[model samples]
Each structure stands twice: as C-alpha cells, then as structure tokens.
Target: MANHKSALKRNRQAAVRNARNSHIRSTMRTFVKQVRTAVATGDQAAANEALGRAVPYIDKAATKGIIHKATASRKISRLAKLVNGMA
Candidate 1:
C-alpha cells in the first residue's frame, strides 16, 4: 500500500526491476544448466558450445549487477573445467 505518489512510483520502479532481474537470472541459470546437462551427458562438443554461450550471459548478469563478478567468474571457470575435462 503505497500512500504517497512518490511511494507509488517507487513501487512501480521496483516491480519493473524485479521482473527484469528475475528474467535475467532465469536465463542465466538456464544457460548454466545447458552447460551442465551437456557435461553430464559427456558430450564434448556440446559441452564446449554450451560453455561458450553460458560464459557471456553469466558475464552479462554480473555486469547488470544481478550476480557478483567473482561468482560469475567462478561459475565460468567451473563450467570451463568441466568441458575441458571431457577432452
């Protein structure tokens, strides 16, 4: 219940941000999952491809402040290692 006009606007802004952040987070997770799925199936080419795609999206999430940069980097590193190990 936002009483003031300013409060109402703030609420609206928060709603939009929430939606956007959630979408970004979900997409990023999906990409990560794709990588993991490929890795689990022991598909070297597919794992490499998924890792390549996931890295940029993960970095984008960090850039948008949805995730910490270190966390993003760690995720990318782990995914890369999984793909590499498939070789």
Candidate 2:
C-alpha cells in the first residue's frame, strides 16, 4: 500500500527487477551444476566444454551484479582447477 504514485511505481519496478534477477541467478546455477556434473562424470572434454560455457555466464552474472566479483572469480577458478585436474 504505497500512498505516493512514485512509491507505487518503484514497487512495481522492484518486482520486475526481482523476477529478472531470479532468472539470471537460476541460469547461472544451472550452468555451474552442469560443469560440476561433467567433472564428476570424469569426462575431461565435457567438463572443459561445460566450464567454457559457464565462465561467461558467471562473468555476465557478476557484471549484472547478481553475484559478487570475488565470488564469481572463485567459482571460475575452482571450475578451471577441476578441469585441469582431470587432464
């Protein structure tokens, strides 16, 4: 119950942004899971490919402010290390 018109508009905008951010976060999690699954399967090639796809998704998520920059970097680094260890 926003009394002011601007407050109402801001509330609407926040709802929209929340939905969009949720989708982005969900997609990022899916990508990360795919990479981890590939690694767990012990398929180096598949793991590498999945990691490749995941890196940009993670970077984009970070750039969009969905995730912290250091968190994204750590994720990418861990994925890379997993891929490297498989090789």
> Scored by CA lDDT, what does every candidate get?
0.94, 0.94
Superposed model 1: Cα runs more than 4 Å off:
none
Using all chains and alpha carbons, the TM-scores for the candidates as numbered come to 0.97, 0.95
Residue-by-residue lDDT tens digits, candidate 1, 1-87: 989999999999999999999999999999999999998998888988898899999999999999999999999988888889888
* RMSD of model 2 against the true structure: 0.8
Quantify how close model 1 is to the true structure by its C-alpha RMSD in Å: 0.5
Best by TM-score: 1
Q: What is the lDDT of residue 1 in candidate 2?
A: 88
Task: Give me the overall lDDT of model 2.
Answer: 0.94
| Runs with alpha carbons beyond 4 Å of true place in candidate 2 | none
Displacement of residue 68 (Cα, Å) in model 1 is: 0.6
Q: How high is the lDDT of residue 75 in model 2?
A: 96
Instruction: Summarize candidate 2's per-residue lDDT along 1-87 as a digit string, tens digits.
Output: 898999999999999999999999999999999999999999988898899999999999999999999999999999899889987
